[model samples]
Target chain A: MVDIISQGINLPLPLLMLLLGGLTSLMVGLLSERIGVAKLREVWMIIVSAATLTSIYYLNQSVQKAGVLVISIWGQLPPLGGCFEIDTLSIFMSGSIAVLGFLVALYSISYMEKESRLTEFYTLMTFMMAGMTGVVMAGDMFTLFVFWELMGLSSYVLVAFLKSKWGPIEAGFKYLVMSATAGAFLILSMAIIYGMTGTLNFAAIADNLRGAAVSPWIIALFSTLVVGFGVKSAIVPLHTWLPDAHPEAPSPISALLSGIVIETGLYALARVLFLTFDPGMFKLPIAFLAVLTMTLANVMALLQTDIKRLLAYSSIAQVGYMLIGLAAGTTYGFMALFLHIFNHSMMKGMAFLASGSIVHETGTRDISSLRGIGKMMPVTSLSLFIALLGLGGVPGTNGFISKYHLFSAAFGSGLGWLGIMGVLNSALSMAYYIRIMQVLLGSPKEGFKANEAPILMLTVTMAMAAIIVILGIWPAPLINFATSASQSLVEGLSTYIGAVLG
Target chain B: MVPLEPFLVSVGLMFVIGLYSLMVKRDMVRILIGVEILFNSANLCFIALSTQVPGFVDPYAHSIVMMAIVLDGTVIAVGLAMVMNVYKHYKTIDIRKLRRLKW
Candidate 1:
């Protein structure tokens, strides 16, 4: 079955499903319109995402057997043409994307029911997921760039989806200009890489350029690459657009954007950075960036009165935490990084979804106005409480477990100072989390009213909360999966290059 | 092989000009054009580098540039759409005026 598709570009099963699903969404929208069926686009979205998850399972099994599955394109293999090189790491990242996408699709059905242009919404959402899937699995730089832009374009439109609003329009334009500039940096980085190694395939580039002596050009390449991927990931100094874009976007998109999209950018940065230079070479700079991102975002989050905007700032803080693992640059550090990515997806995704439900019912994002609404929306508030606790790294939550590993990984790698700073920031972040909790559980203002979110939204948030707790207490399976995933990147370099060169 | 210095120098100059326009220009459309200029400089770098390959120009870089051009165009298109929306709301394309959302 895979052989037949080798005639063109060989995409992993899940990516192919998403891309095909995105393309057909418009036709399905028309068909549903003609048939006058309600929720047809919503149902299609759920099915496509569910199918994507299942395909990732199958692909994982094959990757376990094959070590690295390189599906060539147009009869041209890697080091020459674009292809997909699926290993455990790709499988893990794509799996996280699919899981969050499926959850968000379900949540969107209820959250966006009243919004017009359902067709375009679902189509763009699907393409966004497809683009992310393609990015993690891309064997070559050009393919990654293509998918990266697809993700960026879809997101820019989605951020401005509520076109009637001045807020979304202004924020979307700012995001577009900033991100488009980053795209140019990406192209420049590619040219630099191509100039250095005369190839863009990941395996080939790694083989040719890894551990080369540092030159002035290499430093230039490093800065360009950082600027390129940094904007999307919301690294400090490039993070101005994020606090706007995340809050302006629809809640489900906020969930996806904050949940996995930024992580996808970090994933690319980790992959390329690891492939190009030794961990020691990048350890100090990334560690410095980690400190800056965490400290600044947490401080800013403390001041946001808007609920979603606070969450957006908190997302940047979480990115800072994840960078500790990257700075550690060990296999263990990578494992912790991947684990945090998944856990944070569940935690942050649920937080946004729950907050979205609150906003949907209450029609306000101002925290002061939301006082004592927890009693009215008991289930959503409870789930959100769990999510907030997880984000704050409270015990018996997956966030705690991952944060423990992340900090310990920093310490273990002889970066005790980074670990200390991380611990302080974790404590600092809890201030805002507690503020939100107090608002939710505090006494209600006069005439304040909000019933619980609809059954679908409640169920999704509750299920995510349950996973957060379940994995927190018993995280062995996920830890093992993360270990293998990181190993595929950190320790599997020889096999990675061999798949192409041997 | 073609000389690499001249091409590199021009790429550097174009990059600085692009950044200058992006920073100094307040018009939304001009900012989009600035992004286009930045993209073109990178594409030209690829084309120039492709020429320096020993005996034949690498078609691979050319192919990547072709796709990159389309990608940038689509990005600019989206930016322009958003600019239209911005104009509708604020009745001005000056970026400084669109600063309602802030800390």
Candidate 2:
């Protein structure tokens, strides 16, 4: 029985932690009402998130092992069954997701204190975290899509958590429509790929693509995949739902949405383009999309007045920068891309949390209504200031480091025009961030109270703010990790082929 | 066996119609129906694709699509519920009335 169970399933430590977290959260949620364990729910969520992060941290230590740690539920091998695979890329992403998820859960404790559906919020958040972790660790396309829906569904519900508010309901409805359409595109693409390759495994598909003739059908498959993933990443022309969805969500959820959810989409796009398909075939289109996304998003962001909406557009712009790196299709490009993921997460996470604090104190998200709030909420204001500077790619922040690498990669890939546009957009983004800062710190408006944000919110904002600065100054460790992960992604194609075919 | 071409074409037509309605319709419930049409079209496409495989119907893909369909139904159901709430709060189903998002 042991041998049978161990046949094709190799469970890694990090995935085990995630699975444990998911199960524990579900169990607590189910028993919370009966056991009258209201306080225990929060404790359980924090413990699960922390344990998941700790396990992912340990997994990062051995990520250079260069192959997948697979685990089977039904004890069956690939091409015939499903399993989980923890690689360097997966572990790195899983670690970051765990970290952000833990922080967001921490932030949510105080954020949702007055809300009645606290248990539902924490329960849904746990499932969402589990889904994201699953997406990162999935070895097969089927597993990725399954977890993708899991995350998407939970997020849709969470977006409308305040059901009484028409804004959230409408926003959630629009989000569902867009997301469902994207899912259709994804499934159709997967069907086409399966039709051609006869397998749903990522490694298998890569192997098939390497030797197969490039037909129009394959091109169509690629196009569908791009559109599917592009919508999730909020790429141009498919980004209408984002500006509505982000601000409509609760602050902590918005932080998660902007910080990591969209990045996961970009990660999937990069994985498919670089890992499963030939990069040479998609280079020009990817570059075009990158340039267009960066330019359009910056322009839209400049026209926004609501603080969260502005940040939402800016998040789309950040995804554009990462796309530039991925489009370059070099090991260095992937490194820049991965590094920007971390940088963007920290910066945006801080920005959203700070915005949440302001909204909590001021009771509004209008940029114009927030005059002189910096003096009112010093800690929140300072955190927002740092995050704004970081977001604008100012010196002494993580954003500058990542954006610089991205520009360098763009130039190195001979897309110097793209690099120039990226710089222009970075500079353009500064106007909005600075404008918000000016309004917050400039002069007191009548009827505005001078009050500090809740301690929980302030702590979360300050923590992310410090990390942004620290990562900016001493980026060697992060640079090395991203570099190695990117190298593993670029170099693992051969190993991947061997693994899938064996 | 029945011909698959007409079924495939009908599915494609349904998808196009759904997109058309979703883009043009202002009523919330109408848009929901449009979403349902789009989802059903995708399911039809999947079922057709499953039939193309040689021997077995590719149980894995079929099952995944089945799950996706269920998810789609649930999502639309949630959307309709939200629309009901929107009507209660705003007293209208016209999306133009929900102009809170406009700059």
- Per-residue CA lDDT of candidate 2, range A1-502, in tens? 0111236445556556655666666678668867886767788889888988887877666554435455554577765676665567887787778889988988988888788877778878887887788888777888888888888888989888888777888888888878877887787787777767777788788877764567888788888899888888898878888999989899999999899999998888898777666666777788888888888888888888899999999998899899899878899999999999988888898899889878876778888888889888989999999999999999899999999999999999888988998899899889888899898778886767868978888888899999999998999999998887787688866665565456
* Candidate 2, residue A347: how far the Cα is off, in Å: 0.5
TM-scores for the candidates: 0.99, 0.94
Off by over 4 Å in 1: A1-9
Candidate 2 deviant stretches above 4 angstroms: A1-38, A61-63, A211-214, B1-7
Output the worst ten-in-a-row residue range by lDDT, candidate 1 chain A.
Answer: A1-10
Candidate 1, residues A102-169, lDDT tens digits: the string is 99999999999899999999999999999999999988888899999999999999999999999999
Q: Is the docking of candidate 1 incorrect, acceptable, medium or high quality?
A: high
Give the per-residue lDDT of model 1 (tens digit) for B1-103.
9999999999999999999999999999999999999999999999999998899999999999999999999999999999999889989999999888997
Q: How big is the positional error of residue A195 in model 2, measured in Å on the Cα after superposition?
A: 1.5
> In TM-score terms, which candidate is top?
1
Error of 1 at A81 (Å): 0.5
